[model samples]
Target: MKVLQNYIKATNTHNFEEVRKSLHPNAVYFFSDQTCTTHEEIQAYFENGWSIVQEESYQAKNVNWLYSGSDSATCTYTYFYEGYIDGKTISGRGRATNIFVKESDEWLLIHEHLSPLPK
Candidate 1:
């Protein structure tokens, strides 16, 4: 949860480095329109958001969670987000599941699946 909390803070502020630190070196990400595996692709996923939005907000709510051993954890939550993009306000009420693994002393994200609610 610490890693995820930092990730949300980093993402809302567009701090890519902190966002990167939250993920494992080989993390996988899935979006409605895309999936990312390599470092370049994952970095691009975060970088690209800067081009489309000058400001954004993200909050996780209504969480259902579980801890599996000392090395693994999983959680599902309502993801609330809004962005200022191209002179318009865009937002989504979504759901996401994030998986994490303990590496040494830090929890790093191993996988994530995010999708928006239907229009």
Candidate 2:
């Protein structure tokens, strides 16, 4: 849970380096539009989003931990994001699932999948 919180905080920083610290070396991310299997790709995707959504803020709500063990954990949550795009404030909500694994006593995000809520 702490790792997830830290990851969200890192994302809010809008600094790829900070976000990278929370991700596993072989992390995979499934976004609404694309999938990133490598850290380089993930960083690019994040940076592009940050550029498009200026002053973006993201948060997770109603987090439910599906499983948790000494080595791994999985959770699902409703995610909300708000920011200025094209000088207009915009916001959206979606669903997210995250998988984390403990390595060297540190929890690192191994996988994440995000999708928009139903119309």
Candidate 3:
């Protein structure tokens, strides 16, 4: 869905309102070092740590919509990403699974789990 692309771009660019547009009110986001399950928690995560990321890109590989119902969809994909952190360029790839729920006919991310592939 286009929303997915918007979500990625918004997060990479640290566009607060744009990113929030794609997330559910109670969406849950999982990070390598922490988890966010509430609006406040997620917002804080983005405002604090996520905002520090200056350049980031997330590309989906072998993406599959495992289940697509009238109101929900489950997607599994490999996310290849690279970015700069504190002036040092770093890169990593990971697997991403997410649940998108339709609200008023628009899909919003309800749950997301992302983990890096082993070295």
Candidate 4:
């Protein structure tokens, strides 16, 4: 979905509002480092620590819709993350999965799980 692509872009750019536009009213964002679940908390976290410094390379490995029901869909994808931050090049590869629900015929993200690459 185009909206899903936009969401990914918004996340890479750290565009919180654009990201918010694609989220459900009651959305849950889960980070690998933090084991908490709350919209406001994650929003604050994003505001504080989410940023793409420079030379960031993000490529989607694959996207597959698991179950596309009349009112919802679940999608899973792998992302390759390589970038530079604070004058040091860093690489982070991970898998991201999300659940998108239709609200009044418009898709909105209801849940997300982002897991980091294994060492």
**Top model number, lDDT:** 2
Model 2: per-residue lDDT, tens digit, 1-119? 79899999999999999999999999999999999999999999999999999999999999999999999999999999999999999999999999999999999999999999878
lDDT of 4 at 74: 86
Q: Which of candidates 2 and 3 is the stronger one according to TM-score?
A: 2
* Residue 81, candidate 3: alpha-carbon lDDT: 72
Q: RMSD for all candidates, in order, please.
A: 1.7, 0.6, 1.9, 2.4
Record all residue pairs in model 4 with backbone atoms less than 3 Å apart, i.e. clashing.
none
Clashes of each: 0, 0, 0, 0
lDDT of 3 by residue, 1-119 (tens): 66667677777666568778888888999988899998778888777755565566667778788998889988888887777788987777798998999999889999989888767
Residue 104 of candidate 2: its Cα lDDT? 99
The runs of at least 3 residues in candidate 1 whose Cα sits more than 4 Å from the true structure, single-residue gaps closed, are none
Off by over 4 Å in 4: 51-58, 117-119
lDDT of all the models against the reference?
0.83, 0.97, 0.81, 0.76
Give me candidate 2's TM-score against the actual structure: 0.98
Error of 4 at 27 (Å): 0.5
User: Once superposed on the true structure, which residue ranges of model 2 sit more than 4 Å away at CA?
Assistant: none
lDDT of 4: 0.76
The candidate, 1 or 3, that scores higher on lDDT is 1
Question: For residues 1-119, what per-residue lDDT tens digits would candidate 1 score against the true structure?
Answer: 56678778877778778788788998999987899997679889878876676677888888778665688989988898788887799877888999999989788889989998656
lDDT for residue 23 in candidate 4, whole number 0-100 = 82
Q: Distance (Å) between predicted and true CA of 72, model 4?
A: 0.5
Following a full C-alpha superposition, what root-mean-square deviation does model 4 have from the true structure? 2.4
Pitting candidate 2 against candidate 3, the one with the higher lDDT is 2
